[model samples]
Target: MPNIVEPKLISGNANLPLAKAVARRMSMHRGMSVGLVDARVERFNDAEIFVEVYENVRGEDMFIIQPTSRPANDNLMELLIIADALRRSSAARITAVIPYFGYARQDRRTKARTPISAKLVANLIHEAGIERVLTMDLHAAQIQGFFDIPVDNLYAAPIYALDILHHFKDVSDVMVVSPDVGGVTRARELATRINAPLAIVDKRRERAGEVAEMTVIGDVTGKRCIIVDDICDTAGTLCKAAEVLMSKGATEVHAYTTHGVLSGPAVERVSNSVLKSLVITDSIEPTAEIKACPNIRIVPTAPMFAQAILNIWNGTSVSSLFERETLGPIYEGMYSAA
Candidate 1:
């Protein structure tokens, strides 16, 4: 209930650059002393994770910025171990800032005897003494209910919209296409932001991680198209969807996704596909192959995360960050960040 004298940010080995970038953005605000905690999250000889915090965090507001991305198991363990360390140190409030929540795709049971791993992960975090969670663009919104604590699921739609507008000055010919029926809502939200028409690609997936059939439900003839989705792992769907749209007479195709989980041959697929460009936020650290791809572009989410952190720390409204007029200034001339 007392004012925070200083905000402590500690990160794991997942995404140190993003953590540092958020720290830099936080420093721009007055009266907020944001710095990295003097801690070490190292691995032992047996591949076991060990965390040691050297600073005194008693009664201080602490945030652990660790995205559970690739090597999900190790990174996830680091977050849990770090939170436990902070709790034992008697921190006033500990928030787990996970940009990408691993195992999120398994939010529900798909078949008999299947495990709902997302909920299990949520329970693990809850049991680890974290009071809240800060993540972005969850695979399923209902995953928030899996946790008893407050969960802030931020969206990258505003950031994507800003970058979309910057690239395309004329929105009259732009069409937003959802690669599948499930993503229509997310695609429509971006469509509304950019004032573009919406379309849907009906696809059938006979097996996991593979699309068997795809049908364009709307006319994309001669219009510049943009496919919207939350994650792009393997990129088989996006690459195929782009081909389908172009075959239907779309002049050009582009894609915007939140987490660029370009695992396996996703980078190669995007590079060789018909998509003119693929824009993604830095929710997950980019791979070397992804960085080398000319068609792939990355936008920073540090400023947005910084503002949300400040709001939450000050007990203000976090939803207002998505308002149209307010987004321009936050992302103005923000092609890249530290």
Candidate 2:
């Protein structure tokens, strides 16, 4: 029989705590010792990135856990360089476990002269010799097609549904609201899981950073509203949506998102907004500002990611790990895409 190569986990500087958590979960689930590979990633005096893998990965299945978050350019380059180094070391296979895939919002061109940066990023990863990719809740589902390699796009509805159910005992009083038209499908999935009604926020974007107006479509009067989306960047859309929901007689408005990019003035906006609270997964490492914001709560995605990675390594079906019956149509769509 051929030698059985155990899976190895490697992490970039993007989010070390999340990587450690995933490693611990994997070790616990497998009933064996699983540790991260020693890979030093740093920047030179001139700001040039350098990567050095201290251990041999020859004939090993390497999984690199790196989220392309803030300082996106630097973090992105770091991931690419690390993958290139692993390829040179003859690792049996390289899978990039990107919990938060940056540049995903740029999957298409809104203007004539603009570039589809997401596709370019996908090409770069393929050029770096990555064999597969595992990501969660892409800004645009179609972004998966940009990659030639197999892409697994995980959904956060299952996790969020559980949390919402636990927090709100009376599900009938709670309603799921999509902050914009584009997010209706995502909100619908969560609504179906929690058995709650659905609402949509009709908003027109005048420009990139500004939302011209917002109108609530469904009845939110006296209802506790839960707004759902994939990413929370500047918090502009979420904050505005919450305010509109409240003005429309929503008793409370809470927001949940998969990835919290939390860019400029996001924390400040969220804190002052009418939202009761904002819950996000730890896909991107939270900054000091995010941590200090009392209204922001972070849920862990490590356990889910850990299970998915293990299934991939063991050549098992990952969709089995989630509740297909509860997920319904979303599960069917994701499976077809995979």
TM-score top scorer: 1
Candidates in order have lDDT scores of: 0.90, 0.89
TM-score against truth, every candidate: 0.97, 0.94
Kindly list the per-residue Cα lDDT of model 2 for residues 1-338, writing each as its tens digit. Answer: 23547889999999999999999988887899799999799999999999999998888899999999988998899899999999999888999999999999899988899999999999999999999999999999899999999999888888787677666767888999998889999999999988999999999988887999999999999999999999999999899889889999999999999999989889999999998899999999998889889999988888788888988999987776467453433223323322
Off by over 4 Å in 1: 1-3, 31-33, 335-338
- Against the true structure, whose lDDT is highest? 1
Pairs of colliding residues, candidate 1: none
231-297, model 1: which lDDT tens digit per residue? 9999998999999999999999999999999999899899999999999988898877888899999
lDDT value, candidate 1, whole model: 0.90
